[model samples]
Target: MTSFGRISIMACLLALLVACGGSGGGDRATGVEPGPTPPGGPVAPPEPDLPQASPTPYAEAEALFPFITAVDIPDDGRPLVDFQLSDAANTAITDLSSADVRFIIARLAPVPEGNLTGNWQSYINRIEQPGVGPGTESRLQATTESNGVFTNNGDGTYRYQFATSITDLPQDILAQANSEGLDLAYQPELTHRVAIQFSNGREPANPDYDWVPASGATENIFRRDIAATPNCNRCHDQLALHGGGRVEINYCVTCHNPGSTDANSGNSVDMKVMIHKIHRGADLPSVQAGGEYVIYGFRDSKHDYSDVNYPQDIRRCVNCHAGTATGADRDDLVLTAQGDNWAQYPSIAACGSCHDDLDFSRHAGGQEDNSRCASCHAEDGRAGSIQDSHRIAFEEAREAFKAEVISVENSSPGEQATVSFRVSNPLTGEDYDLANDPVWQQSNSSLNVRVAWDTRDYHNTGNNADNASSIAANALTSALPRGDGSYSVTMPLPIPDASVGPGIPASGSGVAVIEGHPAVAIDDGGSPASIPVGDAHAFFSIDEPDGLPVPRRQAVEINKCLACHGSLVLHGNNRADNIDNCVSCHNPRNTDRETRSIARTPPTDGKQEETLDFKHIVHGIHAASIREQPLQLVGFRGFTTYVYDEQTVHYPGRLDNCLACHTDDGFSLPLAAGVLATTIDTGDDHRDPRDDTVVTAMSSACSGCHDDAVARAHMSSNGGNFATTQQAVDNGDVVEQCAVCHGEGRSQDVSVVHRVRELP
Candidate 1:
């Protein structure tokens, strides 16, 4: 059907339903169960003809950002450069009257080739780290409005004249910088950078930077581009930090160099060291060993990172660190201008930042410098080498053994399912036996398969850890037969009586998730240990006569989630490397209804149940730190309570940039038609997705992050409501007028408002 035809049909249906006071506002009197939407819980019916999405280009969205067009320094010997500021379209905004413009002028002290002289920090400790080192650094002077003279030429560009004179500077001040016959003055033959941050009183704050030769020379120009802002924006959306001005990493490294020090914390704020330390924040050995990681910022503001959690494993270097130029030499990229630097570049400062408690005397052979560090730590077959050392644990696990859900048999309506799976050693190219393999014989290890119904959403079946709707059985104990290099386990599936398919709802399928950690002995730093293999999921159709099963929607990319969360291993390795498996348990109908807190993590109020719905929980968990109320839940049959307090968590990205976690236009409003409302107050009854005083589907998700009263009131005023679960399911469901104002192509569309910078 034509797109317009589909939309018109839906529109007519909406009008017809509304005229009859459709299920959207279900008849509260007779409880006849208003019905227009689907009968699912967390997920709505897949919009067969979802509206066409048109994402706004980054530049147009951030129209007021200052894009520098030109830079010049006259032969007048002044330390100032004339620069122009342009709008998003590359045309001049001309007016800088209300803009906050600042500039930075700094010269790079390039490293010489084959020079180990400055490849690493000379930890001037027993006092503090980074006694002195030659690395990229900003100048002592940053152009402030008071110190620098600002000129409005009345053209599209403006100029900032510096108060300091280049020719009048002392030559002997940087004897170390000039040791190699390189002068720090504004020399055209040397590498110099001019950076600026411009923002109008109300427009977006943007940063601009350029690399120019003070004095053009080949040997002394040090520049590294291993990563860019887009790489960071991958997770951070738009990272605005350093007093919310220095957004670009290129502009940041100029100032946060080895030469700079936070006098208060007695720590180096160098990009290489500080960034490493910041990423390994709470995990740093020193921080874990009763010490705190802190950095004193501008005006001596104490920036404490002791409680900060690095989302992914710090050993995953490639996760955040990558570049095209191979670092400035990539070796001196962080330390010295030598080849094979960065991850391969072994430096005490960089390594010691995370392994702070390393016994320097015993390790690296008591080396005080980085000269001999490369000899033993070379990226070879040896284990401790950079590339070898940084390998993720999951990679190691993959080499030992992997589990795959081979097939499902005898899975008919109200029947037991025979699941076939295989565990094989990828390294040896052989299958592991469940009966004889010692790896599978460990008491601490386990193997199980979870059976959940209705791939559309588990709303039809109660897929809990200890429920029939979601049945999980020990595969090892239920092993039926061994044939064709695969093992079979037969387990009963509790199909509901109203099932439309052989055992499931029409258009629905089933999932048999091979979930468990069978111990496979692998090298853990020269010793043997056991690790769980990744979860293997196999989907089968219960309704489709053609045998083609439709799987659930891929909401969030696992790679993106793994990019930040090294391994999505939650609940002590029970669920590993699978978001699909997670949603099976964390569906819309799931909640901590029967939970009674054993840890007193401060029990819930008991008046309301905390939902385990993937949409609501994921949103609430991340936005917990900012939400007006905490995201509190109880689980494990009342033994556990998980509370994401507003005070503890600190989400690093912009909350409104829904693309940070959602896929496609998932976050865009006008939620799917049948996406059922979450049970807000389980009206004097058991907690279920079917019946409860609930927040409507649209309001449910919106309120997850924006949980303020005014926001809910606004939603309620605009056709979004809080009703009984059945009430919402009956009332044509998605009644929110949000899309008209906030949908994909609306004036305040999310695609445009997020201002997501697209990278080519």
Candidate 2:
């Protein structure tokens, strides 16, 4: 569903490059000096000397960092535990004193199945509203404040010895648990888990381990890999939560079990239920049925997720709950652990969390027990299987059928372009005569081929120079098929003159695009029939009819877009999944003139027409939430609402990581020297190809997201041009000097500033 928003703009404008500072010249303790001492001032005191202890020397390292390697609680009845820590550093480790780092430990016990979590936190020392059901844990556990102090060996590791022994909980914690009427017995024989959370101020690392005290085993029967941290970082940059308390999912699940609940709202904060409800925020049946999902946290702060609209379809469970690994060789799979919990297991608490409107009270077996729920909800059950229920029609159709563009020919300037393509069942390895397919002949089914010129940049001079022809299924069937399972259709290049020898269209390359969906009975009794027609594009040249044509630059790929947004069926399903197909109409010169036509919808929208320049539109739309002046762009026939939903927009990852979309460091500065400036909406100009006002290429892209006066002023000072005629830019009179400061290898390089994983 997210066509342009997935590839959001990283606000890497010139001003920000200064914010991602350069190499430091001072030690970690004393920051770089502002200036030399005043020569005329009285000499500063240097007399007092204090006694120093023989400090524990830190082990050699190449860059002090946080990485806990091991955590163990000796089961020999000693009130002691030990954990090892390793770190990275560009220089020998020196600054990591006991004062520079902190550590905490949590002791957990594995419980029986039917319990929401495999393990429960025995380390959480306090509980709130704990009479019955679920209650929140205060988590004021075995920290230095509780006298469960750790001894820093100063050799890049710390061995934390609790004040209480492994044989029992602290007296106070025990008293509190007993007063709360809890059953937290000291079960040393059961699987015991120790989680160590460490931080070095700059970075954090959490390491957890499982062991059976009685057997001295390092593995656990209760371990589960329902989901891992890496899966979350795909969207959340580093996945740190609770101010770094729950740094990893392993640590998070310890307390966010079925035992946890938000007392204020009476809603379960179980990880299984909370995560689903949070992600399905606005779409939660209970929410739509006029209820709010709120969780009162630390200090009783209200966290409302009612406006949390997930960027993709929530039905795509695999987005987060990828099924268990297929290979038997995987370590996590071999364990008797829960991996792929989303699909393999079905729970009333988990399932009902999202589908809250399903009143299981009236159902035959009710919600008390989930033992029999799998009989009908298993992957291969008789009906309402988890996989079947969450099936995406588009993904299914995509797997069953394929639409591919084979080639584009006779693509010279001023000449009509011919396209040869295929429509077939990819699963069966058989081709379908488009004209003969009953699905294609049915209502809401058709194919459209568009031919655009000058692939180097689609301006081809005046505007969005592309011509499209909607071919009826029967019309294609009527055409003679080529010997190779393909059919060809010819359409005008619409380059103002198609026959002028070696004209604009004949220069770089001509892009041929085809897109459309067929009405199928695949979902006959399901919801609306699944209509999926994956679009494709190919470049061709008539200038050298037999030559391997030069194609347009591939900045963004459909596959990359699919990483975050599983599929993009835009504008009534006409524009399928190809990002390249988008540029055909959303070229540098394109705008939303047609949609804003006084004839289309109410209010005549706005005074100006927004430019549909690919990069500008992508940046403007995605970064709209942060801009002082939000972008307004209604699509064809107002396919999508133009009103920027600023209030509800939430970007989950670090905005600086441009690699989420950009390829080959394309997001770096010094863009192609003569790149075309994009037309912007200003002063009521609605020209098809606005000749009056335009924003210089780099300015258009950078300013699209940082659309504020101060940032614009900064961009303006750096040779960024805005609200100028295209001739002013095309005449070589305007040039951007961005690379001087923000290029690939400069001091404040764009790549350096935007890198999410590397040290700044």
lDDT agreement with native, every candidate: 0.56, 0.56
> In model 2, where do residues sit more than 4 Å from their true spots?
1-79, 89-119, 129-147, 163-182, 244-246, 323-337, 379-384, 460-480, 493-495, 498-506, 526-530, 542-546, 599-607, 681-690, 756-760
lDDT by residue for model 2 (411-479), tens:
555555667888778789988777677777776776767666566666544222221112122324434
RMSD (Cα, Å) for all candidates, in order, is 15.6, 9.3
Pairs that collide in candidate 2 are 62-89, 62-90, 63-88, 63-89, 63-90, 414-497, 414-498, 414-499, 415-498
Per-residue CA lDDT of candidate 1, range 304-410, in tens?
Answer: 67666666566766545653323332331232233235555677777788788897778845876666777777755343677677767655675676789988876
Please give each candidate's TM-score. Answer: 0.77, 0.81
TM-score: model 1 vs. ground truth: 0.77
Question: 326, model 2: CA deviation in Å?
Answer: 6.8
